[model samples]
Target: MSQTLGPTIAIDLDMLQTARERAETRGESLGKVVLDMVRKSLALRAPVPEYRNGIKRLPWRNFTRKVSIEDVNVLLNEPE
Candidate 1:
């Protein structure tokens, strides 16, 4: 049986050259090199957690204090 292949993607000349150099250096095919890079990038990405319900609080959740122009200047260490 014939195997199915992925669709062809168009890349810029510079990017293609870079991938070719990488593939030559690693003694691997350009397709394999690019696939490896894509896999590595995907692996490094943070997985999205499933949210059950309600609002999600971020790291800067407690920084809800109101600030005036003087407060902003003070925070920036700028003179009035």
Candidate 2:
């Protein structure tokens, strides 16, 4: 809230679309929606990192479709 940054952060395209929808419905800026998401996410207790063979394996969630630039264009241009 005290600072602003240029468009340098990289986010998953699918998740960005979801945030855009939320911003539209809530009549908030995309950045505000994303900032709230980050706040909620950091408020949660961190997930226990899974490990295998002494190697750290970060967790992942299932995506309905593969994330790609092509997919991003479609999602951005898709009508509600």
Candidate 3:
């Protein structure tokens, strides 16, 4: 709520409320919570998911193909 010249961004009400609660619980300012979250997100890499009867693959490029629900089911449910 400052009129000072500074970069500003809008946050959703629900997310803001959650962040505020987190800040209160941690005895830190909301700014600190946001900054920590941003830093952690920037440090994260693509997560590898375990597939049934399949090896994990990554560094996918030009992979524009979309998978349907049936395809997802097939991948999820492997023959016993």
Candidate 4:
């Protein structure tokens, strides 16, 4: 398995504990359970907008701050 570094994210501890217990009962890691929940939630909440082959384009393009060499290095070195 590969690993990705993530920043600290604050979540509801009570809800997280409940999900962890449920995941353990199903023989899954908490991360896997959380990812599944996120995928399901996105699917449920965001119906595909009508477009070519249901591909939803982002609203904005090239609107962020300029990317630096460090950003390119990180992208190139990211695990696949």
- What is the C-alpha lDDT profile of model 1 across 1-80, one tens digit per residue? 87568889998898789889999998998988888877887899755554446655443446667778998778799655
- For residues 1-80, what per-residue lDDT tens digits would candidate 2 score against the true structure? 67777586999999899999999999998999999999999999887999999999978989788789998999999999
Off by over 4 Å in 3: 1-6, 47-80
User: For model 3, where is the 10-residue window of minimal lDDT?
Assistant: 52-61
How many clashing residue pairs, candidate 2? 0
Task: Point out where model 4 deviates above 4 Å.
Answer: 1-7, 46-80
Query: Against the hidden reference, what TM-scores do the models get?
Result: 0.49, 0.49, 0.48, 0.46
Q: Lowest summed lDDT over 10 consecutive residues: which window, candidate 4?
A: 45-54
Over the stretch 45-77, how does candidate 4's per-residue lDDT look in tens digits?
745555657686665458569889999999999
The positional error of residue 51 in candidate 4, measured at the CA in angstroms, is 16
| Top of the candidates by lDDT | 2
Q: After superposition, how far is residue 77 of candidate 4 from its true place, in Å?
A: 75
Candidate 3 clashing pairs, residues 3+ apart or interchain: none
- As for candidate 1, its clashing pairs are none
